[model samples]
Target: RFMCDYDEAGSIGKRYRRQDEIGTPYCVTFDFDSAEDGCVTVRDRDSMQQERVPMDQLADYIAARIQF
Candidate 1:
């Protein structure tokens, strides 16, 4: 199983920064549009690249890249 954390106490930037400081491999963000689009923003900590991934496929998408 994968460990997940829910954090919404600060701004998105702050949240990203916090995760970056801890060397998180990826960060998934569900914003207002996610409810309608069923997509979440997946950010790569190393590349600082962001992509939209459908909620249903999120797990597989991350699993494909994660090396745990």
Candidate 2:
């Protein structure tokens, strides 16, 4: 699940779908602000809801939401 430096050859939306079809629970994207601001965009699979969370606290944040 470590894709911080992942910049594949496709639109981000396309990448999201690829993850979705494969049953990825969430997709965390790192951008310019990620390193500087210490935040990431976390997108949920079932609801497609997204949120910004501090990178330092990401693990705890996701863990809280995972049902199992």
Candidate 3:
């Protein structure tokens, strides 16, 4: 099973750092733009890379890379 955490207590960068500290492999950010584009920013903890992914395809996208 996978776990999901919702945090909105700080700046985006701070939030990312918090998750990174806990070894979260990925962090998805849904901002104002997401309301229009239906996309979210997916950040990779190790690589520190960010990518915009469509909401509809998000499940399969994360499923493909997540390891149990």
Cα shift from native, residue 1, model 1 (Å): 2.5
Q: Write the per-residue lDDT of candidate 2 for residues 1-68, one digit (tens) a residue.
A: 33333546698899899888988888888877888988999999899999999988998888898776
3-23: candidate 1 lDDT, tens digit per residue? 787889789999999999988
For model 1, give the 10-residue run with minimal summed lDDT: 1-10
Candidate 2 TM-score, true structure as reference: 0.82
lDDT of 3 by residue, 1-68 (tens): 45899999989999999999999999999999999999999999999999999999898889999977
TM-score for each model: 0.94, 0.82, 0.94
Error of 1 at 20 (Å): 0.6
Q: lDDT rank, highest first?
A: 3, 1, 2
Q: Which stretches of candidate 2 lie over 4 Å from their true place?
A: 1-7
